[model samples]
Target: GALVYQYPRRTICKSGTSMRMECQAVGFQATSVAWYRQSPQKTFELIALSTVNSAIKYEQNFTQEKFPISHPNLSFSSMTVLNAYLEDRGLYLCGAREAGDAEQFFGPGTRLTVL
Candidate 1:
């Protein structure tokens, strides 16, 4: 079975601070990790997609400068939200996908709270 795990299910940070989280892929090779943000209002946004052996692609509203991702190998990945603000508050998810699957298996996610 394929699974993605994320640490610190909830986090609270000062308005001007930053937070770093991790993602782990288990039971399968995670060729790609897609990061998304779910807001309290239920809006969703695709942040970025990090694929092994390929260039990382970030969505229009997101940039590497703001949400930098790291894919060290086929089974793990991570990302950071720098200079956290009110707008940065949300549920950050990590979706892991293998080579043949069009759908991704998502982690429970880290709930971010900004003061």
Candidate 2:
């Protein structure tokens, strides 16, 4: 079975700092995994590929550096966010899927709170 698991489930960091979040794709090959941020009382905003935005502008960490999607033959992926701010606080979801597959498996996600 294909599954994506994100650790920490939740995290709290000081404003103007960095935090590292990780995701593990298991049981099957993943061609891509998307990281998203769910805003408070708002829909998820695009953080990056296979991932995030409705009226959302992604930060560099998500758009430029692109937390590399795990190869279809691999099962792991990671991303780190630097300089977390109040606007950056939200639920981070990881969505995974394989090539030619329509179903996307989602991880429980890591919620971030910037102090």
Candidate 3:
């Protein structure tokens, strides 16, 4: 079994600033971490997937330059939102999975608010 914990649960930042969020996996090895953003319209968008010892794969509209991720080991991961803006305000989630596992354990998500 696996469990993920993300923090800070909610955050507020001024426009044009940046914020970093972290995700941790417990009870199992997290071979991969998938970052996602849930939009205001309640749509989940895949941001990127980071696998241990492999390159991070970014989705179509996502770039590593904007959302740099760090997955240095099996149980920890973090990502930074560069230059926060209104459009970037959303709930950021990290789903971690073990190797060869189809089920992902999701964190409680980091809610971003830009003003």
Q: Which digits, one per residue and each the tens of the lDDT, describe model 2 over residues 35-60?
A: 77888999977676532112223456
Top model number, TM-score: 3
User: Worst ten-residue run, lDDT, model 1?
Assistant: 95-104
Per-residue lDDT, model 2, residue 48, is 69
Worst 10 residues of 2 by lDDT: 50-59
Off by over 4 Å in 2: 50-62, 65-73
After best superposition, candidate 1 residue 82: deviation in angstroms? 0.3
The order of the candidates by TM-score, greatest first, is 3, 1, 2
lDDT of candidate 1 over 16-105, digit per residue (tens):
888998999999889988999999888769999889989899999899998989998998898999999999999999999887466689
What lDDT does the true structure give each of the candidates?
Answer: 0.91, 0.70, 0.95
The positional error of residue 39 in candidate 2, measured at the CA in angstroms, is 0.8
lDDT of 1: 0.91
Output candidate 3 Cα RMSD.
0.9
Q: What TM-score goes with each of the models?
A: 0.95, 0.78, 0.97
Q: Pick the candidate with the highest lDDT.
A: 3
lDDT order of candidates, best first?
Answer: 3, 1, 2
RMSD of each: 1.1, 5.4, 0.9
Candidate 1 wrongly placed segments (more than 4 Å): none
> What value of lDDT does candidate 2 attain over all alpha carbons?
0.70
